[model samples]
Target: MGLDFVTVLFDSPFAVMNTIGLIAFALVGSAKAIREEFDLFGITVVGLAMAFAGGATRDLLVNRVPLVLQSPVEVSLGLLGVGLAVALSVVLRSPENHPITLVADAIGLAAFTTAGAIVATEATVSVFGVVVIGTINAVGGGAFADILLDRSPFILFDDFYASCAVLGGSAYWIMGSVGATGSTAAGVCAAVTVVARLVAVTYSWNLPTVQTLGVLSERMDDQ
Candidate 1:
């Protein structure tokens, strides 16, 4: 990826927005987890881990250095989010207020999905690669957050999160293919992801899981 400073600066505004969103999401998740079981230090670890875990892994997969390493702003926003989470833990005494968590996750997913597409476009990546990176960036944090909380992946159970991210990233790649500018593409992608995720959640749209009995019947039919 031959990204210059100018492009990384101007063409990647979505990256900044997405990075901030991730920080907030990580913090909320971490704070909730801390309030449930962990202490202050553990909260910090979970917050940082969830905040940067996915994008860091994505960068390594794409053979690029992590953005948080190069930008102090990323650290600042992430830490601020974590701090807010810790503070919130002091008052909100119940997990029943999960709406806050949902909102944070949605914002973070939108930002990361857009950022992933932007980065893929800058790298002149294929459509599939763009979608892959975008989806990963969008849901990576949630996956890590759930694991830290000792829960199964959220994407597998609810919210249609990964599908929305993949669709949004696909939209970004399509728009870029038509020669759209970076900022415009990012905005479009973010909007699509946010809308899709909200609609899916609102309507409880999700795929049905297949059980083992159904699988055995299909296999017998094939035989």
Candidate 2:
């Protein structure tokens, strides 16, 4: 069974996307830690947390052992990302906010979103479940990292982020509903997520709050 799983892992689109997400999110997390002047141990912890938290949560939801607990490769990939962030910090003044980091975050978001959608589909979950799981998988890690950094989870108040994952998951479900192959659906999902996230970053797009929409002011006037 282990051999068969290994073979499938090598051949699976899920594996590829998972690898990208692990590395990219680890780098982003490590970069943020470095910017915060965290010690090496703290940086490593944050990086691994960002890489594994979401996947672990997803696995728990599906009643499976977390892959990070079973695979040394997963930890190794996360460490590699941390090393890359450290190296970048040696050269770049602010690696956390660098364009490379921004792009990596977008790619990571897309990869994890697609991976989550694929896993949720395999679990025979409802379409709503797929979107919920996908969005959580994409943003859960970053939220965890933020908490470690002593900040509120940026997903709650940050610019358009989790919505990209929602859009990607919706696309994945729609494509599958239309009889698309799993690979095709996964590709479309990742593409949609990455593009949406990148555009949001580029344009500084943000979802409006109730205050921004004047709902509070209107209610006050009515009272």
User: Which candidate ranks first by TM-score, i.e. highest?
Assistant: 2
lDDT (Cα, 0-100) at 55 in candidate 2: 90
| lDDT by candidate, in order shown | 0.76, 0.92
* 14-41: candidate 2 lDDT, tens digit per residue: 9978989999999999999999999999
- Steric clash pairs (candidate 1): none
User: Ten residues in a row with the worst lDDT in model 2?
Assistant: 4-13
| lDDT digits (tens) for residues 1-223 of candidate 1 | 4466435544456656555566766666676677668877777777877788778877877888998898886777678778877776677775325567666767778888887776766677677889988888778877887787788977887748899998899888888779998777888888898888878877889776667678888999999
Regions of candidate 1 where Cα sits further than 4 Å from its true position: 1-11, 95-97, 211-223
Candidate 2 overall Cα lDDT vs. reference? 0.92
Number of colliding residue pairs in each model = 0, 0
TM-score of predicted structure 1? 0.83
Regions of candidate 2 where Cα sits further than 4 Å from its true position = 1-10, 215-223
